[model samples]
Target: MNGIEEEDPIVFEISVVVPRRNLKLENEGFDCVEVLVNEFRNVGFFVDRVLGLHDEFIKLAAPLETLGVVAARLHMKKTTHIGVDLPFEWEEIEAFMRQPDGSLFSWCERFQCYRHLIHFFLIEKNSDVTLKFDGIEIQWEPGEALLQRLELEGIVKQVFPLHDETKRNKLLRSWALNWWDLISQPIDEIYVYYGTKIAVYFAFLGMYTRWMIFPAAFGLILHFVDFGSLKLLVFPAFFISIVLWAVLFFQFWKRKNSALSARWHLNFSVGTSHGYKLSGREWNCLQAPVELVKGSGIDKTKEKEDLQRYEWFGYLRRFRNDVIVILSIICLQLPFELDYAHLYEVIESDIMKFGLTAVYLLVIQYFTKIGGVRSLFYAVIYWWVFYHALLHRNLMILRQVLIQRLIFYEKQEKARGRFDWKDTICYQGGEKST
Candidate 1:
């Protein structure tokens, strides 16, 4: 090859001025300029020039210096064409250049010209400058000849209106409506679920403890005391318990299904319209006819009113009813279990047992109201006393043994663990490194 072709490399330079106040708020110190520069580089712009200014100059004169120093340092090692401009009066220029920290001026040998009148000069230019600010156009030739003519205009003018009172008020109203919708809707739905579940469970347990446990225990004690063949009562007692449990279970199941369906409708209505697709479990659980009611078409105000009505009737009132029924049964069975001969004698004598019953009921009620594990212990104790009087044999003990077996069997099956040699190899690096 007689001649090898060589092409001039493309050189690009950009300058950005940041106000000193803005820099102080952002960086807190001059040393943080490097961090700012790296952030700009990450956005793909190659900064080949920088200029730093004193705080007073940026506030009262040009604010370009705050951003300039950061820009130059970023390109300092990569290109010889990199430069920085410092704003100094002509009188101080020589003395400032001579300072030990003033080595930044050595790069200024490439300065094209100085334009003093406009407070801006062309230190170096590989190309012309073109910029637009607030609809005003700016163009500079590829030299410093007209640099002094470019006016040092004050802060840029606004092209758009600063305040739109109508828009602001509309945004605030919309935000308030959305926030109310979020709080009221979700809370109502959660309360409905909890209330229905608790009510059903309480009702079932009450019937079981009252009709089955209390009667059977008392019948057993009578057989032992009288030495008569009263074992025949055991079959009738068992039959009644089963019947009570079945009826209660059916009622609980019905209410539980209704509550679950309502919850599904609530979830589907709120989430689907907002572009969220339900997960597989959510989709399966909420796939009910009630959810087909379009949430978008439903008025939130009307829905809220309807939900409040349902919450009062279907949840709060129903739960209170169930609580009253359960506690009434518990109170009625306590004396039968305690074998209070005086109370039994009063009932047998045709005198009302109300006074003694009420007094003992209040005592039991007070003890039950004490919270925590203590309350649970007292409940179990009452259950035992009632069931023993009704059945003679310890039904509570039998029930507890059955429950423990079921729970422990499941736990034992799930407790099996797996070991893999691959896991040991994967973590082997930890042993070596340490």
Candidate 2:
């Protein structure tokens, strides 16, 4: 909420004032109340039109919208910010997460609150809302009735600054327990058990943290240790272990993703209303009709094939552009390399080697995002895997892994004929899906 106090609450059609005066913090009510109201309206609009699902169903799609909002804030614009107080009782949060009769409405309502928090932090200037890490640092801080509650119950253990080694072995129930309980339920029925995607997302994060941290430990060990002549035994063994662990982790994920999809009924089949047809959502026009073109002498099958070919060729074109872009970059840098090597005898700075390389790779990634640069996007990924991996550039590696997952899932959908070429690119953006 954009907190501002004023006698005339209505500044714009989308901004409303909520009056609040607590403790010494006497001021205006939030201004952006209407903005979030509109955001939910937008969510409703998509659910009603595109998702073709009900309100309870909106709980599931809302996470996707929330994620899409975060993506937009990250990539496109940071125009809106809102915050809502979340005061969840530990027992209630647990009961909602665990009990058969828990209210999903309450749980999802909290998630929407969290989503607003995400939007607030998306604006770089407003990122100070969190107490770093597990929220333990502020556990002893006195609570105030006026400000938003930062306490998150059930997700974290009772965090205190001083560690009691004596109680190290003592077990405490965790917020993670809530997610685990959801996971332990029949995967298919998890939807009925908990209508919140945060549980699944957190569960995946737990698994991913373990998987990623284990490899990083090995990397750190390699960093600190001097293997000397026995290096032969160390490097190869670490590499093989990482690769083996990665394969096992991903294989497990493949099954997990499949199980969830199946439970959610996303298996695409003709006339199937449930599976790969969650909302029967297509990349289609929701606005003006796309008028059919007058026929040429082309056969229908040939026309379809041509359409598909042209659609997928964007990848090929992207690759070509990536090559051209990289060549141009190298051509510009060739003079510097030569000068560093001979002419001016200037040694290449570390900034040029690592920092500038990251910038170039980022440019490639950005280009890939801009509709015409898919090939360069992929090229950047491949280069990261090869060279960045060699340098142990974990950040770039992480980005590539996430991007590849999206690409992989997209390809899977395409392969299953979730939508034909006509429904893919030819569809309208429709109200901008804004």
Candidate 3:
């Protein structure tokens, strides 16, 4: 209890749901639940079972030592500035260092370690072992993981990560619910709690929002303040200023992203990060690397071919998905867009135009819904559409709509591209992981 209390920061909860009736067995040689609990305990997980009405819950937590051992074996990349990643030598544990914040690993890394250990626990083939849970004989196969088998058999209902209440409350008070600090966020604390992906996302969002103020102010001045006959000069000046601001903003953002990655100890350029991911997958209960090598021997040529095949397969899949999306837009959305544009041009009545515009907005929203998206793209589009229809009354309103739509689409495209770039390391080889 003392050890568990001390390691609350890194503790994760895993819920195992079993039917209330099946939770207890009368004439059981070896109960499935008991065996499962024993296996988890054997692998260094702290397990606690709680009885409920319909299903029982088993919560799990890992000690710091267990996490360190797995992390060492996985060869997770450490910050080059701090230290290189090396195999965990338990005897020489003192030589290993904690992160700058004094924590050994981030929440994200710890969870991965937990997943690997649970998913990869091997079963020795001794006999035809069947565990009875209320007369249900669930078959346990030799040379396979018990958890995976149970999961497939519907015995283990679901395995998902749980939040630490203590840490979550701390974040809620200091970060989420705190409005006193609008621009600044506790980024390191966020990274520690939520992991790299979420923390990086917030960091990017904060920077982007802050950078937008300059353009927002410039646009306000252009709209409200009159330059009279110097309108041409003002337009060009505003345009150039915006372009420069965008260029500089992105440049600074790149620097910021790189610094964050280095600080977080993640390598972006090389396959080390990629290797780390693949290693995590490989370390799963599917099979050991040694076993794989022994079973097939080293096939460097085949491995090369396989890598190339996977790479090409990924490209083809992406290209195909893009084509489908493009075709869909051309076939479904383009016609509506064209029809709306033509109607807006020919129709004279501002009232009819307003009604038509509102209908068009609804149609676009319908299309977005059909596509199963309520994304930033549609949100921005909706804002612009409503702004033009309600507030903007001018001779060049239609032209403005077209221009704004084009600009919005371009911005959406760039945003998506940036998102993909950021996500590449995390999700590039997603198919292979599972």
Candidate 4:
């Protein structure tokens, strides 16, 4: 254990150790987190399980050096006993680094952060086993040594206690600026880490607008509404103004957020000082999903691509669902074929067109409940792409690009350490080596 004077501000550096490939904490999930907690309460003396998880996380963290949080995160992932939201005791923590300022923190922050963690625990009452903020209280045999509840299940199913960086940073920056006494606190590192994330998101958003939406949109708009016939498209200026309106708001916020971070002596443009230096493999979580999907490396030793790929099982499942949906749509259409064909006239009329669209939307929603949803939607999307007057082939190309990128987005979430249930990555030798 380490000791230190608590005079200066405490700088808690955010940990970056996620699961190797986002392995699941629980293999099978219940309907909800509450249900899971209730199940635990049903069993007797489950708080011991949380303690056990804490012990295991400590043991795992000792060897991983800076990966204490990551190790704790992984432990919570495999078992629902405890969470990484708790503070690390210095006597127990071996070694860890705060990457933002390149400062090492250990041995003393445990006690220093205790006051901040004062409100972490809560006590409440329930039917089966009452686990409240004050602590755990439950029914037990008369011979027990303590009054603590052995289980916590009736009303509460589960809990995922996670520290929210956005909220924390928001409060910290506000307080640090407002209070002079809090200047010595270690809020900068955490602020910098989360600040960098916001910065990157905005940076990416700016690029996406510049490249993905604007270029093609303005080019098409100008082509459709030429100088000779500007009235061809309804409210051409209105469309242009809509795009500019969003641009102005985004620019204004970007400046405001940057300025707020600057007041706290944080950099809004870059990731934590250490984050900028991390290797590509360790920091893959920061990259764009499309970039991850497009990159691949296959050699004599490896038959498959190095980056994450989609699973055929998921694709087949979606296909089957889509198939069912299309079949249901067909069955519904059999009864309304005459009515739908006749609605072509209503679609052309200005006033009746809205009613026709509303009816179609209602019908689509009704049939969407029946089956073949993905396929049916895909077909509808393709129909629009093909039927559009301008950019006929361009829409098809955009559709394919979107479809391919979205498929990876939907399935490769676990690879990026997302909380995705259906898809998860198998451990790729991230276990302890020694």
Pick by TM-score: which candidate is best?
3
Better of 3 and 4 by lDDT: 3
lDDT of 2 by residue, 378-421 (tens): 44344323433444456654464446445554665686685676
Which of the predicted structures, 2 or 3, would earn the higher TM-score when compared with the native? 3
Residue pair clashes in candidate 3: 120-285
Sort all candidates by lDDT, best to worst: 3, 2, 1, 4
lDDT of 4 by residue, 1-434 (tens): 24432223323322211112122224223222222233333321122222232121100111122233433422211111132233333334433233344323322232222212221222342323322221323443333211122212232222222244554676567654657652233444444434445544554454445544554676687667656644433343444344444445556656766764444433222222332112133334356434433443324223233322324545787999989866655554433333433343324564454444445445544454443344453355334323322333465444543454355444545455664422333233334332
| Worst 10-residue lDDT window, candidate 2 | 8-17
> Which regions in candidate 4 have their CA more than 4 angstroms from the true location?
1-98, 101-206, 209-226, 229-434
Q: Estimate every model's Cα lDDT from 0 to 1.
A: 0.37, 0.38, 0.69, 0.37
The TM-scores of all predictions, comma-separated, are 0.18, 0.27, 0.62, 0.23
Error of 1 at 312 (Å): 1.5
For residues 1-434, could you state the per-residue lDDT of candidate 1 as single tens digits?
A: 12222322322322334333332333322222232344334433344433356221111111223223333433222112222233433322232222122222211211211112122324256775554333334554556433232334322111111122443355446433556553222222222223334534554454445556555676577656654454344444444444344445556556655774343222233222233222212223344312522443456675566446545666877899879856755553444334433233325332234344444444444433432123432344345444444553556544543354345434534553223455676689778888
Error of 4 at 219 (Å): 6.8
Report RMSD for candidate 2. 24.5
Clashes in each model (backbone N, CA, C under 3 Å)?
A: 12, 11, 1, 31
- Worst 10-residue lDDT window, candidate 4: 54-63
Q: Candidate 2: lDDT over CA atoms?
A: 0.38
lDDT of 4: 0.37
